[model samples]
Target: MANREYLKLDRVKGDLIVLEGVEGVAYGEILEITLDNGLKRDGKVVTVDGNRVIAQVFQGTQGISTSNASVKFAGKPLEIALSRDILGRSFNGIGKPYDGAGPIYCEKKYNVNGRPVNPVSREYPRNYLETGISAIDSLMTLIRGQKLPIFSGNGLSHNELAAQIVRQASVKGEDSENFAVVFAAMGVKHDDADFFRKSFEGSGVIQRVVMYVNLADDPVIERITTPRCAMTAAEYLAYEEGMHVLVILTDMTSYAEALREISSSREEVPSRKGYPGYLYSDLATIYERAGMIRGKAGSVTLLPILTMPNDDITHPIPDLSGYITEGQIVLSRDLQQKNIYPPINVLPSLSRLMKDGIGEGFTRDDHDEVASQLFSSYSRVQDVRSLAQIIGEDDLSEIDRKFLAFGVAFEKQFLSQKTDEKRTIEETLDIAWDILGILPPEELERLSPQMMEKYYTQR
Candidate 1:
């Protein structure tokens, strides 16, 4: 006969949940909690074997014993923190305030493990999100209520790029619509967290910015929920408060690794490359949350960052991410090695929504033609580069040599920018003209004569 003993889990110390008769018991889905001394707790389902279940506690592992503690399962995963008050507030992964402001005076919360939204109810993403960066705006335009990822490698400046987007992204002024930023970083270093905090404050967007951070030193379990909590807050702000939101999740790779670790700890069967079997579905839950809901006044836009191992675009992280996201902004290690600050590889970077977001009224009449011309010119420059290497520079034709120079100038001028540099749409367009001036006016058949006069420089 199997003996059953009821156990009481009293507290959570860091990641370890303190309970009776179970030490080091892994916690799963966090259920509802009633706080002691007004300090709330979240529950998780730690183990399930042959109908026997065990859970670990969150918050602290102090003062819990067999006789005093009590627990009940709500038959669901941890409820997500979903409310309008989540913004401008900081929380650990388990939805506890690390900001020291105390418990949220809110009327509600929701399941953190989001339910699958009905596909038929999904609204098409039509609105535009204007990120001040020209390459992104002109080539890979970001649409409102879209999910995009920044595929970067080690030593890449994805953080700075993401920060720039958060600072600059807005909607067209015609409707006078504006958006808010919800930036969350998982498993980031202490200095990085401080940098982000200071960045939002210095930008004066801290009032509108909602930040959820799990430091590198924070328990891995926290990393798993940081982005989810951030999204939950974003959902509240956008869907509830009628605000457009740009949610930036830097280092999703860390989030994935954390999930894998938890899966291993729980002794779940691993799948591709030792990742959890449900990695795809788990990601879909988060990514699918960003979109326009039918009858909702606001939308959620997502930009997640994932660092590639050894600059491998084919790696599981970026590879799987590419399948899920609308498109990626690929950072170049070669460019970084060359001392390019931003290191954006424009050719490889793509914004799938570019076609829908850019047009005459949206940006300018020449936007499409200009972008195609730049793309064509840059791609051709690569051929010229290879030829230069083969035949030696002295053996190249005048035009071929000029094309090579243009490539170098384009990378250094357009792609590379100092971290502090901020350029408006007008400034970026003018600079494009300045660089295009090196090519003959006859070669620019993409633009009309009127455009040539208004935007082009006459030799």
Candidate 2:
């Protein structure tokens, strides 16, 4: 049968065009809506009831009248053309080329809704991916195929941290040659998008970075597809081209908000905080995409950044995300007020997969012990600071005073660094040792005798 064009629409409401008496319409199938003015817009089938269908127009439903618009079903789902050439390009939220470069040569096209990696086919994630940041490399190490989210807050420096990771991230050994980055920015301002492009270009890493940007002024519907387009590109590069891909999605809160808006437009039942009921499973579809497949020579690592609403980690967005991802890197408002760059609060930040990634072969032999000692020693510093607040610091015990000094040095020396500065794993470990040296050798209970003999020095 020929593609039948329905000449009448049942209703038009807030980006949704509903049609009645529609036949053979499958969910997720593409649609072409032509208005009386002869202008056409793209849409996809979102809901299908008996002889009634609801489709979301990618562009807003403005200027579309129910009697004047026509709908034609396209027999395929939304897809983006993929190839090796997309590595250095930039695209809009819906995978259309945003850069001046022409359209990509379509070697193959991939559906944006990617299939989840099979549990049985997934290889245990191993080996560390270095971000060249001391706080992360020494304490919360990001494994190659793990999904580690950065939990930040409004007005913090998460954008700068994300750019720094894009510039300095690398795979160890000869595999470094195959490392690439996929950066997707959703609901960012025009200036923020410019900063990312310029930063990547200035660092001379743009050639290895693929960017998908969705500006704040763009359609909210496009924001919903931005990360999916990014993931499709990353999946192509990693699984098809045999390259290690690091996918960085910034401001996932914007994505979640867009999801909520669309859900409200559909008049769907709301869950916690007025978000859609399927928020957890919706997030899992994206977060669960990162992994290593058995017999495949590549991996996809995800680092999604979301700003907690009012610094409330219990907010539905961050709360559900924490349940899906491997671990989190929580940024601190207190540290940012002190002018720290990354502002990562080490106490709550953790990487559950760090144990298998760091060792004698991956980063360094003392990585595990150094990380443990840093965590243990820092916890004591917090206690000492609390005690000093009640009584005068001058009246504190000798060890307590030393802990105060150690805390100060730890934040300024270890956590704070230039935005452009890059440190190797070796240099990061050395700095950790230097900070640990502030305390008496006998107080270092986390470190083994052998590790202490080589790295520990009393200052």
Candidate 3:
């Protein structure tokens, strides 16, 4: 036990090491292993069963011989340094500085594996966080502590939409100084990373953003740590420093894939689509991290973006994520084909927390009604659209023709928005009423008489 420093690696398989005769090794403890080539590689203990310890080497075991390896446990789990200086900086998945600013000057270090928010201290999310996109702000509203994910497909503009939200998202009427963004991108392509960097910088929000990126070609094990590191930073900023943090993790599908790869490496049994059965609890570790502590001045709101495989929302990644998060914003391939800029299919997308976040004090007084009426009207628009496809539009009744016209205007005006456009909640609500006015007043069943009198106008 005293000579655990020179323990031999009993087995090596694809970035994983199996060693026996290790005493007192704990799970998640960092290890510095010296390879036979005199090169040092970092590893972390993933399992500890009596005297048999399994560890994952961060650097692949390319030139290592299992007979002559030296392992030293760091005596603690993986941790990251935290400071106010973390803002306006970029780092790789392991929290190493990548922005060329050198190492962060800080005295505080935190384990990347964060604990879930305690239920007693949890406050229900009620404050509105405006992203300035009409489709999101006016209908699928994002609250301060809610976890809402955006479900997209290949070649969709989810990246652009995510960038726009990071740029325009804010706590309405609150000063920008109190808000911050922690963006964690998992296994993204180089071009997508560059787009996010340029978009944040160009929008002048880069100063308040802390970005964590894991490129597609990087080590697959690092992908498993990226979001956890980002969430740890968000917790430090929000709970410790009283700064409202918006954490956006893009391409979560890649993360889940990484989990599957590691599970295969460990020879674990596969579940649906070769994913592990614990996928739900694994996702919960990330999604459940978002919330407002009862007495804290700051909150962590999550907006995770995951691309659906081949546009299938029923895929394991999205299916499990939908069960964990508050709600989802589903992007439509049909709308994308139509050349819509932000191609959000509003009918199927929803925010379950929309009710508690909007209304008199949080947003406009008529926000709830306006959003309901818009949802109802737009849903009917779908029915009319399907019917029009069966029986030609010219053969419809006069009122049906008016409904068809309203549907067209709704998609063109209310649903479609520019990438650079920033619409306030009030403006978004007004635009909804304006679009609803295209139909006769009787068609607006969801709107109250008071709202109709205030916003609705006779043709």
Candidate 4:
């Protein structure tokens, strides 16, 4: 019935297009705009106040003449084209399939934005999404329906680690309805895009993957919408299609940068580091979209990667990100400088949902113990290193001697891994075997007997 009525356009400004005379017009109304060329562009209401709404033109409003064009609001928000057909496909920041593939064979389109999982709707995340990596699974375990951010600095190998997790992570015995990785890369270059494509294809995980890219050469404004579009598609597949989805957002710094650019274009008031004031809530809108919705057969997990500008955690983007997301896996600049591959600095890194996702039958019984032990050992290594700088490694105590070896084993064993390598939960656990070798069996009080016998090979 709402489709029969229409509202007239009041004005159009930079990033803000206004419509007049419709109290309760609502936010994000899907509309069809008949442009001059007779091509109807599909757009949505972006901002609304007392019936006046502003819509962002996804296709770029070049020839959209006010007098010529008619608007038809479908009385709803933007929805995505989603289904099994979305698999192995590529789309722009908006959800229009562009891989030379025809229209998606979908049931129906759903709203791009949806409500977050209610506190009552949330079930305890007991199932472990085994990442097949020692550093992650054995220490900072990733749980299903959890938001775990990867904190990486510029020029680090975070991208490679993200890609590998997509390839290697899965749930045991649930092979059929396992992971579907929704990878969104915003503001990356053509070469970076190509590298991800090639790496994903070579790994043969491209089939279960849906990628929405806003490259460096593309429209910068598109970056803000890119993750939303990817999540839109992800939501459809995970909930409706009944598949566990892992939504990866690489370089959220790029997304934030795009936001700053648009805000500057509009001459909006800037906040810290020239970012918008509502940056935290804006990020929460995306990151919180990930979770297990009540009664839904599938879940959407998030692993958003952010590059701290100048490796500064205090930077607005990574700072607000730390506040919004559950926990972060911080990659170390010093370890990277030492030629370590992942260089995930263990002490600072944490997974808040680790306890909920590990232990008992989910992973091994000894998982928590081994993880805590590793944390203690590595943390002491830092203390030893600082003292060594003051008094040297030679003049250290017996306990300090063990810490030195633990530090080396941590880097060579825990952090470094072949990019081409894919380890199972067992193999990753085996690396735990080598790291625990530095401390004596009595000092390894955290590990259980089966774990000690299986992993603690006597030196």
Candidate 5:
């Protein structure tokens, strides 16, 4: 294979450049750009139409001239070096070491855009991943190999929740030792990056974690690559090394915005909210990468955190994501206003794989019952509260008043917790029992007779 350098540049649009006289350039092939001033940048071939090749430069085109700049086709796709040593290290979105650890030289290098796992080879996600947060573990349970996203709005505590999950998330059984984390932050602020680093280091889980950060100041092109790079490392860890890898990609909204930016620069037809039409399929490429491979001892579970634009759940980014993922963990602005730390609304949020993962051998025998009863009871609380506003609480029935009280206790005791506090599945279930005890045994209709006999502890 020969590396060919082309000097005939056609056009330059922001970070994208067009080159004619290119032969055999593959889509996603790595390219090297050399400016007239001797500065070099890396780019990837995004499109190839006959002899016309379109490459997106990782570094924006600020000081490059069409007649003077040159491009070299690397004849291969973008790849990241992968090995067991990638653990406990940090890299930029493009997989260059960012934590002062020099370039990683390994025997294996994986394409950043990993090959999708075949549906026939996928194993059912059947194990629990306890995040140590009561609001999630007790209600919307996270399972290994599931793509569960966090739907949040601006100014909510989503970042804190993400950090907490990374800090406290663990496997329940003997396979705990095989757990590792791959965290990717796209278009996040400097302080937010520092917060994640500090949180991970403080929790002492930094050793089992690999981080890829694309800061707000970084080129938008890299934001597009951040999650892919992180997923590549996760695939290496999970499939090759047999470690259960949790990949957390935060602020996917930013990643989508970057995609839209590039689409606009390329003059492509836009879809809903000016996003590209392929948004759904593009996102699926990332989310669908999460799952268990048949006969493989490891799995990849995705916890993508994306903030809704103007808190609109129907926005294209979240709407398309919800369609692809197993379920969503929705944060509440109303609850956040009330000072709830997690602010996870149990009614709207769900874990489709929770049933397959919990009860008996997974977490606890009472987990399913307790979660269902809490949701039912809290839903009634919302109804009673709405009624109280119409006809004052003083005029309401005693049961409605008890429902109101239960709601308050549920949020304070069951939902809200200190940032540093970590609760086991048993503790989360016990808290649910204590909160459900406020209502009469008849009110707990969701629980079975066996569940009631064992876990129901009412006064």
Candidate 6:
């Protein structure tokens, strides 16, 4: 269909503009709204009902008048130009270059609303992706093509942790040249955006990174498009260029809030916590995009971070995310109070795919045994600490005292690491062994006789 123009504007509601007598306008189709003063704005068709349509202006509807505004349907959805040159470039929330660089010279543009990968074409994710953090690498190992999210709260150090992962993450035996990162920040402040950029640039990893930033002051509608743009670029690089892509979307809560705002504007009924009813399926569209296709040479791994309100894990955002994602890495406020850098509370954290990704051919043969022992020992430590609080510490038994000491060493040495410190898988496992040795031989039941003789005895 040819592009159509309409001079009728029914009303302006919040950031949305309604039009009557609009025909052949499809959902998600782009629109060009020109004001009487010749200032033009971009919008997308959000809701259509026969001859009536509702669209959201990308800039805003502040000065749009119902009598003078002109609506022209672009007959296309929101799209971004994709190419291998997108690496190391910075773009706005809508995928327009903001790095002082000119436009991307590309022959093809991809729709930001990507199609879901068919379940039949998905390959089972295997092989660990190392983040160089002991708490993550040894415990909740991130597998290629897995979607593992970080559950955090306000004022925590998740930003630093995210930047650190981007700088240090790598795949075992994979060439550094084939590894790339796509970082997207939604509803972030100026200072926070600067921190991410400066951290990556200072670490000299910006060359392999693609950044998409949507500041808090920008239009809230743009937040919904930020991650989609990042994912589009990632798919292009991973599937077309054959490069492994790690997509990190920080503060997904902001994106959900944007959706909620639009839903409210459209008078849609709200679900849990005043969010839209389709929160689960909407989130799935983004999270489900991470995987390896059967015939594809590369994969896409997602590490989405969301801050929980009042540290409530049962809140709708994190609750729904846990259901869709493979696993989560939870950050502990209590650990942060103890001066831990990453502050990962490993007790509640897990990686469902770690079993298939580690041991024998992948990581070390002892990786599985060592990880199990650490989990069991740490769980015992928590029980011991609780018991000591009820009774006096001086009255505790020798084994109980050993458990408390092991807990301290585990947190201080194993879980906590400098922001810039990068530990190899071997080094992380070695540290686990050193901490586990504090327990008596009887307490190390998670390890087999062979692993005990090989690693435990040597320690």
Regions of model 1 farther than 4 Å from truth = 1-5, 8-28, 31-42, 54-76, 80-85, 174-178, 445-454
Residues 287-351, model 2: lDDT tens digits: 88888999888899999999999999999999999999999999999999999888999999999
Candidate 6 lDDT over 1-459, as tens digits, reads 328878869999988999888778898888999999999999888899888899999899999889889988988899999888888899999999999988898899999999889899999999889999999998999999999999999999999999999999998775557999999999999999999999999999998999999999888778999999999989999999998999999989999999999889888999998999999999999999899999998999999999999999999999999999999999999999999989999999999999999998998999998999899889999999999999979999998999999999999999999999999999999898888888888888889988888888422
Candidate 1 global TM-score = 0.87
lDDT of 3 by residue, 262-288 (tens): 888878899999999999999999889
Cα lDDT tens digits, model 1, 1-459, are: 112223454444434443444322233544433434444455566564554444545543355444454554454465555555566677777677788877776666766655566878778887678777767776677889889898888778888788777766777675334467888899899988888888777877676677888888776766777788878777877777888999999889999998887787666899877899888878888888888889888889999999987888887778878888899888888888899877778888887877876667676777776777788888889888888788899999877777777787778887667666766656666677777777778767677787787788843
Rank candidates by lDDT, best first.
6, 2, 5, 3, 4, 1
TM-score of 4: 0.89
Residue 414, candidate 3: alpha-carbon lDDT: 82
Put down candidate 4 lDDT per residue, 130-199, tens digits, no spaces: 7777788877888888889998988998888988887877867654565688999998888888888888
Task: Compute the lDDT for candidate 6.
Answer: 0.92
Better of 1 and 5 by lDDT: 5
**412, model 4: CA deviation in Å?**
0.8
TM-score of 5: 0.98
Tell me which residue pairs clash in candidate 5.
Answer: none
Q: What are the candidates' C-alpha RMSDs?
A: 4.4, 1.1, 1.5, 2.9, 1.2, 1.1
Write down the worst ten-residue block by lDDT for model 3. Answer: 1-10
Model 3: residue 338 alpha-carbon error in angstroms: 0.6
- Model 4, residue 179: what's the lDDT? 65
Model 5: worst 10 consecutive residues (lDDT sum): 1-10
lDDT of 4: 0.79
Please count the clashing residue pairs in each candidate, in the order shown: 14, 0, 0, 0, 0, 0
Off by over 4 Å in 5: none
- Candidate 3 lDDT score at position 272: 97
